[model samples]
Target: MAIKVKCFASMREYLDLSEREIGIDGIKTVADVWRSVAGGKPMPENTLCAVNQSQANEEFTVNSGDEVAFFPPVTGG
Candidate 1:
């Protein structure tokens, strides 16, 4: 299966990437995608995620050609 991964805001800098298409098999959930992209590095806490533009949780299952995005927690004055 192929999944599209996007990093936004501070996540882009932490991941050192903005977007990528990854090919994998037997992978499930947003957390799985995070592990794949992180390459053994720890994922930041409070990271927000979306799948296909809708908010999703870590347990959200991902399908082929699905777009998964990660964003750092938002803060404002």
Candidate 2:
């Protein structure tokens, strides 16, 4: 299955691509998707994730049409 990924902020630079499509087998959690995309480098400790704009955890199972988003942690004054 193919998952649409959107990388933001520093994460985008590190990965060297803002958006891309990846193929994974079976149903995998959001974290699993990250690991696959990151190669050997793990997902950032403070990364925030959303599945179709809703907050998603590592254990959240992903479907073929899901929009998996990854962004750096947000901070405000």
Candidate 3:
């Protein structure tokens, strides 16, 4: 099975990606997804994460065909 991953805002620039499809084997949690996609690069501090558009945490479980998204923290005046 496979999962879709999305990077948004600064996360896109940092990871040099907007979206990708990854194999889900052995990938359990959101943190595992990060480790797989980040490719040894540590996840950015306080990076926001979600699954299927709903807010989630690093500990969140992930399943095949899930859409996982990562975002850099947003700031406004």
Q: What are the TM-scores, per candidate, against the unseen true structure?
A: 0.89, 0.84, 0.91
Clashing pairs in 3: none
Top TM-score prediction, candidate number = 3
Each model's lDDT: 0.90, 0.82, 0.93
User: Model 1 over residues 9-40: C-alpha lDDT tens digits?
Assistant: 89999989899998858669999999889878
lDDT of 3 by residue, 1-77 (tens): 79999999899988888999999888999999998989788887789999999999999999999999999777878
Of models 1 and 3, which has the larger lDDT? Answer: 3
Error of 2 at 65 (Å): 0.8
Candidate 2 runs further than 4 Å off: 75-77
Rank by TM-score (best first): 3, 1, 2
- Once fitted onto the true fold, the runs of candidate 3 whose alpha carbons sit more than 4 angstroms away are 75-77
Q: Residue 61 in candidate 2 has what lDDT?
A: 90
Measured on C-alpha atoms, candidate 3 has an lDDT of 0.93
- Cα distance off (Å), candidate 1, residue 20: 0.3
Q: Model 1: residues >4 Å from true position, as ranges?
A: 75-77
